[model samples]
Target: MPEFDLIVIGGGVSGITAAAYARRAGRNVVLLEAGDRLGGCCHTWHPVADFWLELGAHTAYNSYGALLALNPDTAFGNLIPRAKVGYHFLKAGKPQSPFGRVGFLEAALTLPFGLGKDKAGLDVETWFTRLLGRGNWQRLLAPAFAAVLSQAAGPYPAEWLFKRKQRIKAAPRKFTHAGGLQGWLTELATGLDVRLGQPVQTLSMADEGVRIVLAEGELSAREVVIAAPLDVAAGLLEHIVPELACRLRATVMAEIETHAVVVPAGKVKLPPVAGLIGGDDAYFSAVSRDYLAHPDWRGFAFHFKPGLLDGDARRRKMAAVLGCEPADFAYETAKTNRLPALTPASVALARELRSALADTPVRLVGNYLNGLSLGDAAVYAAQGG
Candidate 1:
């Protein structure tokens, strides 16, 4: 007999949700994580005991029903509401209002004609361009959305980019956990069998069920769920499902070179705003801690185009943007944020892969299978996809 009924690989939003669900269903489950912590993209950096900043995914919304449902306390009261700050665009090296670039007449003209249009088989550029006119998409939306996705948003599947889901109206429309999103996710994983720093090396089928091979030893489970990054997932599934793994390898993973800094609030001349869209610059955006105020410290995470700048160069640029010097930074860190470069074709691929694995004991979930958002991954995993 298998030692466990289910084994979930990876510890991001997807794996956690899968483990949580299977555990609740009375299955003997254990979660395996490759990293020192969970919450793959819900990464938060704590520079001091009292202050923390988001280095990856910055905001959570009320429409994230799957995530909000995991909250174990008094509903919305426990969530921290973000101050109403807005994202801005950088023009001529100064912060500019997002609306400053909008072409009102162009949008007004296209809205009537683009209404009720179907989004099937379309990319974000095509759908939004048609809906808002080329000028508006070029001037106002393109760069703004790139900042949101931390990549070139043009090729993203229109349908998967954003979906309409029912909102938890009682919760703040945009909020984070008390210690930040990562802290909240840790709380959500409470009591579930989680083993951090346990990276699964490979998988195979045994008489009992699936065998999960790790660096040290191995374990057997009646079922296994893979919730790692695209390439990692592809490599793990290669020997088990050759064809499916080959197809997964065809998809590419996008990387964002993130450089972050924490500085005293007194040194910054940039006003209180959510973030800055890079637009044609060497980066996608600069996300700030302004959404949730800190008494003396302010932090920013600049998601830059890979290989565009070196460490010293990025530090100087970050200081230039923040209206301070590199020396003003009290703390600093760097990380590479990766996501699947998904397209309309990738959506079809997801469905195909899901169907192929249905009859097998191996299950898969992550940002690639669904949309890139944590909530989207949660919803997909909650559905046992």
Candidate 2:
């Protein structure tokens, strides 16, 4: 078995960032990925005739400190170029306002106290009313936040909503890449030895180092970062701490289904808009017109918010939304059970888990531990890895 100074499990942004940090520190680091390719959820694919489609993450907000710190020269690089990035919101199956640079303003005006009673003092609206005054929440913020977060996870808690809104309100006008988010991963993985298709089956701590048993072989590392899915990490830790596994078992429970919807080139006119869905169902989708940026490649992706729609219900909803038969898009679906979520329980469990492993030398990182955003993962990786 080969040995290294650090071994990172999983190849998502979290794991990749960890590997990059360790390698930069002059440590012998090897990244192991179960999939044939890297970029866990940060994936972009350009099919034969279709536009660029992102199977996982869409775009990171400019406020992502970790991502910026990792690559200081943001003026030009792969993270997201200065163009091809815009924001919009949809209401009643139409743009909230007429097209132009006014989309952001329109969204800010309409969505804030999403789905709650128009009268102040209700859940989301109460907080918004406090921010923009009583009636202002109804006109500008609630609907917009509602429109975006509605498709995301749960009701936008007052605290998180305020923080996120402030950040977005102070962000750059446009962002993204001509080749898509894949370039960010490709650049970040440079100089690191990544072993794809290597699924780690077991991991253990030894007096000298950590031992990782993969499907094909075994390897050792002085320190290991368990950046895989919570369940995967819990399974490997069961032998070490069964009680921790039990606590983690009920902490996160959400099966996610991903589908890529192709909008015919020049056929569908989608003004650039991206946000969380509004309503009780919590579905988040980002609409992009410049992922590929070519006249020929036209494509968009819709992601089902974890724990939002059940399998059959989600399929039906997607079919109706896409205006295509179920079978037409069924083949393009990718499903991952136990997708990481930021539920209250999961959040609490993350704190508990962190304390549990604080002195163990095994750092746990992922979208689950932090908010389910590439920015969060990158920030965490840069800060500690």
Candidate 3:
């Protein structure tokens, strides 16, 4: 007999949600995480006992129905609401509102003809350029979208960009947990079996179920859910499903070199705002902790395109943007965040994979399937994909 009813090969939001769903259905399930902690891209760095900085994903929305449905409160009762702030762009080392860059006349002229265009099989650059004039796309939308995605954003699928979903009115529209996003996700995995520092090696279909291989030993489950990164998922599926594996392996991954710093509140000369969008600059975006004020400190995470700067240069650039020197930083941290480098073709690929795996015991879920938002992973996972 299988040792478990279900085995989730990953412990991020995707994996945890899968495990949670299995457990709720009264199945025996286990979650394996290679890292010491959960929350793959939702990393929160704490320099001191009370303060924390988001090194990865920074915000959550009420539209994340799958997550909220499984939430402890089931309503956003306990969630910490984010304070109001505006996202701005910087020019000549000064801050400017995002609207300042919009080409209103161009937008008015092109929007009418662009409204009825289908998003399917179209990239963000192509879709948006048609929807808004080239001037508006170049002047405002391009960089702003890049900042939100932490990558070029041009090749990303237009359909996967902003997935429409209903909201929970009682909950705050935008919020985070007291401990951080990581901690919030941890709470979501509260009753599930999550094993940290456990990396899966390979997956094979057993006579009765799926057999999972690890460096330490092996485990068996009637069903298997792969919620790992795009490349890692491809590797796991290599033996059991070669064709699907090949398709997934062909996908490229994008990297964001993120550097975050926390300084005394008084040290940062720039007034508190949500974050800054990098236009043609070295970085893509810089997120601030201004939405949730810290009495003694403030934090910022700058996501840069890889290969542009080394360690020292990155720190100097961050300091310059923060209106302070490196010496003013009380705490600092860095990490590389990777997401599927998707194209318009990916949307079709995701649908094809979903249809192919529908009748099988194997399952896959992650940001790559839908959108890159925290809600996206939860929704896809909740749907058993």
Per-residue CA lDDT of model 1 for 61-177, tens digit only, reads 999898788788745677999999999988777889989998999999998888788887899999999899999999878899899999999999998977989998989999997
RMSD for all candidates, in order, please: 1.1, 6.3, 1.0
Per-residue lDDT over 1-385 for candidate 3, one digit per residue giving the tens place of the 0 to 100 score: 9999999988889988888988998989999999999999999998889889898999999898888888888666679999999899987778899889888889999899999888999999999999888998898989999999999988999988888899888888999898799999999999888899889999988878899899899999999999999899999988767898899899989999999999999999888889999888889999999989989999999998899999899999899998999999988888999988889878888888888877778999998898888898898998779
Determine which window of 10 residues in candidate 3 has minimal summed lDDT.
Answer: 69-78
The TM-scores of all predictions, comma-separated, are 0.98, 0.74, 0.98
lDDT of each: 0.90, 0.61, 0.90
Backbone clash total, candidate 3: 0
What is the TM-score (0 to 1) of candidate 1?
0.98
Superposition TM-score, candidate 2 onto the true structure: 0.74
- Sorted by TM-score, highest first, which candidate order results? 3, 1, 2
With a 3 Å backbone cut-off (N, CA, C), the pairs that clash in candidate 1 are none
Clashes of 2: 22
| C-alpha RMSD in Å of predicted model 2 compared with the true structure | 6.3
